[model samples]
Target: MVSDKMFTYISRRLSSIKQTPLPFGGLNIITIGDFFQLRPVKGKTAGGLMSTLMISVSTRVMLIRNICTSDGLVNGAMGLGVSLSSIQNGIPIKPIEHTFMFLGHQIVRSQFPLMPSWACTVHKVQGLSLDKAALDLGSTVFEKGMSYVALSRLRSLQGLTIIRLDPYKFECSDEVLEEYSRLRDTLSPHDDV
Candidate 1:
């Protein structure tokens, strides 16, 4: 999850380079993320070229004790908001509350649920497989093995989609390519031992 602070920083950098104001004053930039995983806690944000969301509960919840022990929704266990009601009270706002059900028990609590979506860093995605992935390889990549790690997350080529892939992003150094060629030749059936 990209924190408001980090987002602002990136937007400023981009605006400086483009010499024009970015949309939303550089806010609300849409990016890809691993949405199925857990979100970050409120206030503390994550996501950048090298950062990932730090999972934490930003909201406080009253866990209505329930009989179900299998799901870990026991008494005092924190629960996430599946739905939220409008705030009311100070600031002419109602108190923020999140509603969730645990083993038929209704739990309501107040806290920031954080952003609904975020882009995860490549390092955070290791060992996980995705059915489909949209990779945004902007103009330049900073680290080695980043391309490999991103592409390997998907099970197959059919599941991979590259966005804004600079041609230079795929280029390899001569030594690396020569080593790869040698390895390929060894695997070729026509090659003599």
Candidate 2:
């Protein structure tokens, strides 16, 4: 998986990639955000504004642990506010075997400027427009906002696809209560000490 830092440097150095020429140039596919549970790592904090958020290591580890176990448990039913960067990390560490082939590829040169044929984690594709998008909504953490980001990545919904999700296959925990309370306290409009 590529880190957010990787994108920062690569996006700038790869300016020529955009003009290299192809029906589909740059990154052709992208995975967007989800809101059922958490936001992206190094994202905004609880201020009702997306800018102040940042990724928390604890949140990252928890999401990774959930992915590693293949059991999407979040402590409780109302628990919320999970981070995407952590979940992306977890999927591979705890990947599910499939009949289809799966490969991990990385763009080292930062000059090729091509949409990778292999699987890429969500963090790599944010803010990028794509010709096609295949979202892996495998866990219970699936939320509308996440879906929105993924679906809207493309100029149109022509090549958008949502993988099938199993309703009876996942579990949730109450740990999210802490997150909700924290966010509420931080972002609440009315406050006084």
Candidate 3:
């Protein structure tokens, strides 16, 4: 759910692009999201991203610099000890010498509290298809509806993987189950349109 304010930012950015060609030599724009999650930040909707807006060249440089490699021993080493020190010290490491270095910007993982990264919860990921996904089922008692939605996002069994599934003891009233059934039956795959 895109908010009016986010739409405004996008609209302005698009108009700017129309006036002048983007500096980056490419016309690629990418959008990553699970609409069922939280609606665009209270007025900022999620949708198309601008490939080239008016952001400073330095910002683009920073983005390129942050693409850490994660391949074999060298990449995995960064996740560990002493080697991490030499790495941070400006060792001349080649980009993505290991597969771990491949930062998949296209992935939109699930969001959770106390976690270091941003993610889209199951509720928001419904009706979507991913090339690959890592589902975080979270606590058992909370958000059963969301849990179902998250698992169903992938089109094929090959693309889905559960990160964790702790046992949950939940108490559901008959009414809650009925409502869930009703909503589940009423919503078709295309209802999101």
Candidate 4:
């Protein structure tokens, strides 16, 4: 949620400068997206604490053992951690154990469970419509229409959620912009009516 972080930064900056506040103190916001996907080559990762919080609050089940029964805690089931422990012998190696309740059973495992949700590259999701989507438009958007392609994955405005949407992310090469302007000029208002 780079956009969420940026929005927060802008809000704080404005408040500090103004000395007065706006409605909700300019904190009204909702962010949706997987945080562990591709990050900007030159930008720092955003929302690290928020991502941890989400993992601590998730509801699906994750199974650590490949042979575990698929009743509910499948290989990629998402769930919350019920308990945690650490085993150490003063050898500088300590493995943390996580216990989770899946389908009324407490499953304990030493290895970290794989997260069920994942962030994918835009190319992987192209041509597919998703009920809900979270997009990270960090400092770098390499190709023209990359942002548009990511956004178009959602079937409707209600299904679209954007993260880290800098104004520069919308900029394209001059040739692409010229073509866009031409297409816009060719559209007639009556065509839709």
Candidate 5:
């Protein structure tokens, strides 16, 4: 993850290049994935297990907890929000009434164990197998294997939409290649054979 200090440095660099004021210099920038990434997602709060959730009716959500595993409400399970009750406090920590029906079964709960799953950064989807994904590796990738990590998350190509594919985005580091070559040399068959 990019640290806040590093991000500030990048902003200053961009400002310097554009000859504008400090901090991005109000330059128009396009993100690789979605518009939601225009703003950084909030870090975990006091709960530490979950962040502040925002949802509405018909919103797609992923179960963050194994609240009702037997009924298929395990972690990573996706569902739609059918209803949302009043907020327990001024904050959205816990909803007073929450209900959703999946597989023809209606489940009601006072506290929800759900999170919005429509979009996320590439780093957030590293180990997750998502049903759908959109990748635009056009000059936005900076780390090695970033393309592979993004492309491998989808279950199939049917759910993937590649807005752009820059071949240069799939570069491997020189140190990695050197180590791979050393390993291959060690595994080579003996000449005496």
Candidate 6:
């Protein structure tokens, strides 16, 4: 969606063409769309945002923004179908704002921040609680604590379906154990963690 800066530009152009100093050159304007739905998006096509996300009613999505005013649907939130699309605030459809200088001109771009959570990288699911998960420990584990981050997402083994988990193939960081100990120490005055 566009901001008032767009309106100012339009008014200036109309005034110049019509040779009138009045706003929009005294042109009669009729604005449509609900106010909540009208707030300008960061970088997305105002009305044509659906085309960018290519989302369907069935597309499961994650809410990347923390819309605190919504129904517990804030950043790092995920939901299904109509629940996502019908959000009155129109968050998922909103475009992420991107700006850069190109050829001495500022270029702006907007895009939806939704992603399909049915399959996501471990980093994406961090700090989230899942009822069930399929651990796909790739052939090579590149970093320590990667396995723990992926495995700890679920509650128990009954809720997990491991696609390929060779425990020996991946090792958790020892710092993880130490950190747990540090957290359990509630009376430590020096514990900033």
lDDT of each: 0.47, 0.39, 0.39, 0.49, 0.60, 0.60
Off by over 4 Å in 3: 1-118, 169-176, 179-193
| Candidate 6 similarity to native, TM-score | 0.53
Instruction: Tell me the TM-score of model 2.
Output: 0.27
Against the hidden reference, what TM-scores do the models get? Answer: 0.33, 0.27, 0.30, 0.33, 0.48, 0.53
TM-score for predicted model 4 compared with the true structure: 0.33
lDDT of 5 by residue, 5-75 (tens): 44456656887888865345456544343211222336533222433568887787766556655666555
- Give the total clashing residue pairs for model 2: 17
Candidate 6 residue-wise lDDT, 1-193, digit = tens: 3334565577668879989765566677666532111222245333222335666776878766655545676656787645543676344455566566657888665657565666776665666678899888876445665677677778778899988876775664454454345335422565343
Q: Could you give candidate 2's per-residue lDDT for residues 1-193 as a string of tens digits? A: 3433343345434535666322123444354533232245563122112222343333322222122123544211112233433564433222222122125543222111112224445544444567887777566335334444545567677887767554443433233344345435444376332
Q: Which stretches of candidate 5 lie above 4 Å from their native place?
A: 1-52, 63-77, 84-113, 190-193
lDDT of 1 by residue, 1-193 (tens): 5543454466557767767554323334576743222232233111111122223333334332332457654433343433344323311112334566656888665533232223555554543677887887765454544566667778988988887686556544454455345446434476443
Candidate 1 Cα misplacement greater than 4 A, ranges: 1-116, 171-193
Where is model 4 poorest over a 10-residue stretch in terms of lDDT? Answer: 44-53
- Candidate 3, residue 108: Cα displacement in angstroms equals 29
The list of candidate 2 runs beyond 4 A from truth reads 1-39, 42-117, 140-144, 166-193
Q: Which ten residues in a row have the lowest lDDT in candidate 3?
A: 108-117
| Sequence-dependent TM-score of model 1 | 0.33
Clashes of 1: 6
Better candidate by lDDT, 2 or 3: 3
